[model samples]
Target: MRALGSNQAADPPRYNATTDLLERNLVAGRAERPYLVREGRTWTYEEVVEATDAAGSGLLGLGLDVGDRVLVATRDRVEFVFAFWGAIKAGLVPVPVASGLSAADVHFLLSDSEARGAVCDGASASAVLPATRRSDVPCVLVGGSVSGEGALTWEEVCGRPASLRAAPTTEDDVALWLYTSGTTGLPKAAMHRHRHLRAAPSALSRQVIAMEPDDVVLSVSKMFFAYGLGNSVYLPAAAGAAVVVDDAPVVPGRVEGLLNRARPTLLFGVPAFFDGLSRLEEARLPDSIRMVISAGEALAEDLFARFRDRFGLPPLDGLGSTEALHHVTSNRPHDVLPGSAGRPLDGYEARVLDPDQQQVAEGESGELWIRGPTTFAGYWRRPELTARTYSGDWMRTGDLVRMVEGRLFCEGRLDDLVKLGGVWVAPGEIEEVLRGHPGVAEAAVVTSDDGSGVPVLVAFVRREPEWDGSDLPAELRRSCRRRLAAFKVPKSFEVVSELPRTPTGKLKRFVLREQPSTRP
Candidate 1:
């Protein structure tokens, strides 16, 4: 890990948003040092700085102005990173829309965020262009042919001068607007600023991952998601470490391949990705893998144990949201406790408060709230939501959790609980019970209406080959009845090939609830 400068307070806190941390650090390093890698090609720190500068100048020449929002809907390519930093260099806010979003969702985000421009890849460029047309935003096609009228190619933009610079940005100025995966409703844009970028490397980088200059970090999420963007792009760039970018989402086998090819010391992903990778029979992970970090969703203890059994390394679980830049609380590798998102990172404070906003006793579950440097400025254009979510400096995480010996145990989302006969029951508890069954590979429990039109618990099970779905539902129901309250046992069971999930690997319960009942 590189030595961070003094903790001593300086006048005005030395905040500079004109130049990105990547450019500043790269310019300070020797020109020949490798800073980025993609498909066996090495880009020196100086080369990366120059490439981003060229891309920035191109966007400027294309009529982008200060504070203009540029939407990046692409995979994890080296050029994608360049375009992202380029937007920063031009004083334009970069909004990374997920390339996998539905066409309607894409149109909604473009309109909602009021993006003035978009840069898209070949696969999604066509699908997104029509949506962009309706919003009157220009589209810049990258790794794709320009088909839409008035759309410009990435080559045209990069052809501009690399010497252009933008006016300085302030700490409070919005730099990015990331949309949260709308598991419940339409995705809301979480506003971030230049100062938020400084928090990850400062608080969570060295303490949790112990990142080193020689280390290669492989992020399993896309650059559009906050976790992936911070872990793979920002942290490595700021720490002067090497990062690997692949223009593909992390699949089960591809994750193992990337690990072997990059020989990364650190791997970051959500729990579902880890679960899928653990299921692979041929994944021979490199011995150089020193750390595995899990975030984006709560990790199951069984998944953690499976990882430990397979790789001999426990997956460190962290709790965070898009509202908070990356992670507010993470378990360090050496100090990790199973099922606990460890104590607050340095320079942050956390609390578990009851409905009255009073502190709860230890070992009691309450709403988890945090006050940290990485907390977002606010939600974009949603003053009512901003006031509801933010109280003074503390950001309400909307997660229900309990604290034991200062460690946090994620119970479930505050809204994920279902009322059965007037008693609150967490769906995760039912899912956990189903996961303990030997035949179950993956399980999701959701509250849905039965054929008779009353709210009933439904368990969707993806079973191993030997288990018969026909008989397993009854067996699992009996098991749950023995372990839980009679009313808490699932009244309906449906076998599914796979559960729908977001790009970040969170189970899409909203999608699951829309399915017709499989019950008789």
Candidate 2:
């Protein structure tokens, strides 16, 4: 890991300040390199530019205009990138809808975003078709079998022209709308401008990762998510580097294989992925990997130590949200303080503030507030939410953190803070301690009812295969009693096979709270 510094030169305004910037880079031959890879097939930047132009022309031919939203629900492939860039070329706002979403959830996103069109892969085309049809949005099927009417083939659309007029857009024009799962059940669409596209590469990429033009970057997440979109796609493109996209599920074995084959200089993944990869003690990775970035969830110290021991590099932990587009603060390899998210990157400012919005003293936990170029304009069509979250230019990240020596250490989410015996306790602290237990493979703590209808701290644990669960509950309670306040210890423990998690690997605490307790 490298230290975050201000040595990188300022990025040119042509990178993403305007809608036509990509076209200019293409014509100037500055973007002529391999941009996408799939099953040994590589698409050069020139080819990608040409494909985007044709796809943009196709969308324009369909009469889509600037600011019109196009929903994209597809697998990770070269075509997905083509459609993404193509929508930008056409001046259309592309909104990514996750394929794993339920049919009802999909419908809500399509209706809420008011998308005029959608593109989906074969596996999910059937499910997406009905939602699009109900919303009267035109559908285009990409990889899967498409027998539906009023649907266009992805191949046919990208073969139109090599030159399409770019949509005229300013720095404030919304370039993309990303929907993230919210605590309240429905997802929220965070609107990002063309200028926000430059945030990751500008602030974190060159400064922290120090990715060179020849470096290959690999991300475990998909491009649809902000984490993957910026780290995997935009960062490499902005730096004239290469990106390796594997259109497969991000399993531990597959991730190892990608590292072996691509020999990526940088790798980005969530904590769960790192934990899974750490399980394979015999798996050897290429020495070319210079940095490993962890985000989307708190990185446990145990996982961090295990990863460092195996890979000989500290996992650079960072905290980010969809509203901020990507990470606002990150721990660089050399300056990483175990369990700290590191100091704010260049051009960004962060502070811990109390509920009254007053800045807290150092080492005192408070809500994390951030101000930077990467922050999204607002949630799409939700003025109230925008007003509540955005104070002036600062974004109120619901997360709580404590600052020490200019580094931010995550405490937990405001929502995750529970009142036990009239004292607030962070579940993350308990979970972190439980993660250190030899018998525990994974753990999630949530406040729930005990059959008596009284609130209590309940812990769900995934024990190691060799651990005996019959006496595990008592053992865990005894461990907690010795290490934690009596009231803060869990009232009950439920040994589960696996804890439910989001696609990005964040523990779904809400799901755990809803689980039926075995204790009466």
In TM-score terms, which candidate is top?
1
Number of clashes recorded per candidate: 0, 2
Q: Write the per-residue lDDT of candidate 1 for residues 1-520, one digit (tens) a residue.
A: 1001112333324343436567656544545677778875989778887888888788767677877888898878877788888887677888887887667877888888777788888767766788888787788888767896867888887745478565455565667778888888778988787778866687678778778778888888778888898887888887778887777767879778878978988888888788888888887789988888899888888889998899888899998889988888889977988888888888888999998889999998899999988888777778899898988999899999998988899988987888887888888778889989878988888888766667888889888666655688888888898898888888888888899988777888978888877774
Please give each candidate's TM-score: 0.94, 0.94
Q: Which portions of model 1 miss their true places by more than 4 Å? A: 1-20, 27-30, 159-161, 451-453, 466-470
Cα lDDT listed for each candidate: 0.80, 0.79
Runs in model 2 deviating more than 4 A are: 1-32, 466-470
Model 2 weakest 10-residue run by lDDT? 1-10
